[model samples]
Target: MTSKNEITVTGGRLYYEVRGDGPLLLAMGSPMGADAFAPLADALADRFTVVTHDPRGISRSALDDPREDSTPRLRAEDVVAILDDLGAETADVFGSSGGAMTTLALAARHPGRIRTVVAHEPPTLNLLPDAVDRHAEVDEIVKTFETDGLEAAWRMFLSTSGYQEDEAGPPPSDSPEQDLEDGRRFFVHELRETTRYIPDLDALRDGPFRVVVGLGADSGGLLTRRTCAALADELGVPVVEFPGDHGGFIWDPEGFAKLLGDILMTENVRIPLARV
Candidate 1:
């Protein structure tokens, strides 16, 4: 079962959806809207109430100013508003990439309203040793996007992200104008803000909620995986390995959902790779 609703947040109306029934779990991503989590959410619906939504300025969610730059702190506030509207005092949060950065912010700022945070491969470049150089590379990618176009910028972004272009080449040619614009908003505007965000490690270490830094089993020691390890080390926790690379939920929904359920059931039980 699924139900949809909207909430008038500070800058815009936030569109959200609810599926299944039980303990509340919010699954989110920065540029990735609710659509991407459908399969995982569905698989978890039987045992957990799953909530997914588009971050403001993308998909059904509407932001008053599309040009407004989004940051992890601001996106954290958005999650709070969504939870308040849904009458959920607290929830387990599963966030990937940019969403993982937002989850860290939520845990840092409002630990009382969160049960646990399962942060999957947040690209917190600030935590990395070569942050300055990495950020410069990202800046160059943004410059290329501004000077050239989406396709050129995308190529640079993929290459920098450690994604290899196969013999078949990039995934389809030519994204529509709207998609290009969204990419502009994300890469040009949001990417730096999200990656550069330094969470209050002291607060997180002593906070009541459990903070689990996750890494994809097949993600390799790329940018995101390295950052995840850094964060877990800082927090004095183990880096939990999941089913697949960064976007694991999409590829192994059943296994992902079961792992999440196990975590919730055992209150911070680490899901082993063998089980997944």
Candidate 2:
């Protein structure tokens, strides 16, 4: 059973949920929020004490300063705050999309707090060979939101990500205006900082924590998939394929959880962790 709770951190109040019993495992997102990870958390709860939360300034986690930009570094610190509140000295982390970037940053910033991090397709645009063009494209998306609207900007974003409308199945929405508002905040307040983040690879490499970069088996040639592989290469490891595309955990939560458990059981990470 999942239990809900809250904690105040920096400029916001974070709402988080915990379920099951065993080693601590955190499943996270950025603007995607706590609700997005519900199914995945439920699936993994049998093996782990799964925790999920809404990142500050998103959904239930309201920020004191809405205008404060959400940076990867800031989000990473928020994750640490959640851990600190839970009294968990360390946790295995599973971060999807922008959350994956948070996982990397958290591991870099607080090496001893993470046991292993499964980064599922973090779109770190700076790592791409055509980074200049990518940044311009993202800027255009933001501009489209400013001038046209969220739908137009989202269409451009989907198209640029090598996905069409059908692929991005419409989410259940009670209010289109609220959805649009969230999208606007994501693009304006969150996207640029997240995409521009250059990870501290030296820290990740030298730290005691293990980082596992993952992508979906059917992701094929998606931009995020390419970047995922790039990051794995940088970490001197091969990309571990989960069951589906970027949102694989949602598509096949049981399978994803099983794979995640299998990864944690892998011999490479079996050695005792050195305290940071």
Candidate maximizing TM-score: 2
lDDT of all predictions: 0.84, 0.83
lDDT of 2: 0.83
What are the root-mean-square deviations of the candidates from the true structure over C-alphas?
2.7, 4.3
- What stretches of model 1 exceed 4 Å from their correct place? 167-175, 268-270, 273-276
Model 1: residue 203 alpha-carbon error in angstroms? 1.4
Instruction: Mark the regions of model 2 whose C-alpha exceeds 4 Å error after superposition.
Output: 175-177, 268-276
lDDT of 1 by residue, 177-212 (tens): 657666778877787788789989998999999988
Question: How well is each residue in 1-276 modelled by candidate 2, as lDDT tens digits?
Answer: 779999988998889999988889999977787788888888877788999998878777888888889988999999899899998899999898889989999999999998999888899888889999999999999999899987787888888887856666337467777677668678899988889999998998888987888888767757887788678778886677788877888879898888888787674533211111
lDDT of 1: 0.84
Give the range where candidate 1 is weakest over 10 consecutive residues by summed lDDT: 166-175
lDDT of 1 at 73: 91
Q: What TM-score against the true fold does each predicted structure earn? A: 0.93, 0.94
The positional error of residue 118 in candidate 1, measured at the CA in angstroms, is 0.3
TM-score: model 2 vs. ground truth: 0.94
Give every collision pair in model 1. none
